[model samples]
Target: MKISEELKYTSEHEWAKIDGKAATVGITDYAQDQLGDVVFVELPEVGQMLKQKDEFGVVESVKSVSSLYAPLSGKVTAVNEKLKDNPSIINKDPYGEGWIIKLELPGLEEATHLLSADQYLKALGL
Candidate 1:
């Protein structure tokens, strides 16, 4: 499993890539593998407010449906509409075209609660 050092991770397997106040969120490589082949995604609406550690959406796989969680609190700015038709992109390129949402983080303080890639790998016993 590849975990990029540039991204922050949540215990729920969500990953966030911070870019100033804006952030792009997605499930990690480990998550996609665990979920098996992704068949569909139920993305949160743009402009919806989400709390840190809260369920924001769902990723349905051939095996089971899994909820996608927010790594930090914020208002959703955009959702990747491409996922509706190409959910398998998550399994093919989870950190790129597979990104699920973009959020305007409430504050930088919330970022402190997230884990570094190294820490995240340790948490998973990698």
Candidate 2:
């Protein structure tokens, strides 16, 4: 499992990469590995306002379907269009090209409450 130190993680297995007041959110590498191969992704439309920890999307895998939660409240600026056609990219590069959405965060401090890479690893009993 690979967790970059620059990102914050939620107990729900979501990651948020902070950039100024904007944040890019996605499922972590550990999450995708556990979920198996992805087949479909249902994402929120651009301009949708979401609350912290809200269910904003869904990821469907060959084994099961899982909810993708938001780590912080914000208005979605964009959704990854590539996933609509190739959901497997999530399993290939979850933290990079596979990122789900970019949001203009409502509260920057919300990210401070999230876990660090080491904390996430410990939470998983790694």
Candidate 3:
């Protein structure tokens, strides 16, 4: 499982890469691995408001369908439309091209609640 040191993680297995007031969010590598081969992604529309821990979307894989949660409260600035046609990119590169959404954070301080890469690894007992 690849955990990004530059990103913050949630216990639910989402990751946030905060850049100023903007944050790019995605399911973690461990999450994709657990879900098996992704077949479809249901993403929230751009400009949608989301609260911390809210269900933002769903990822449907061969193994199961799982909810994708918001890692922080924010308005979605963008969605990864490419995933609609090729959802498997999430399994190929979850933290990069497979990022789900970009959010306009209400406050950067909300990131404090997120775990670091090491902390996430420890949480998974990896």
Candidate 1 lDDT score at position 53:
80
Alpha-carbon lDDT, every model: 0.93, 0.94, 0.95
Show model 1 residue runs off by greater than 4 Å: none
Q: List where candidate 2 sits over 4 angstroms from the true fold.
A: none
Which digits, one per residue and each the tens of the lDDT, describe model 2 over residues 8-126?
A: 99989999999999999999999999999999999999999999988999999999999989999999999999999999999999999999999998777888899999999999999
lDDT of 1 by residue, 1-126 (tens): 877999999888999999999999999999999999999999998999999888999999999999988998999999999999989999999988899999998799999889999999989998
RMSD of 3: 0.6
Tens-place lDDT digits, model 3, residues 47-117: 89999999999999997999999999999999999999999999999999999999999897889989999
Evaluation by lDDT, superior candidate among 1 and 2:
2
| lDDT value, residue 31 of candidate 1 | 95
TM-score of the candidate numbered 1?
0.98
Distance from true location, Cα of 103 in model 2, Å: 0.5
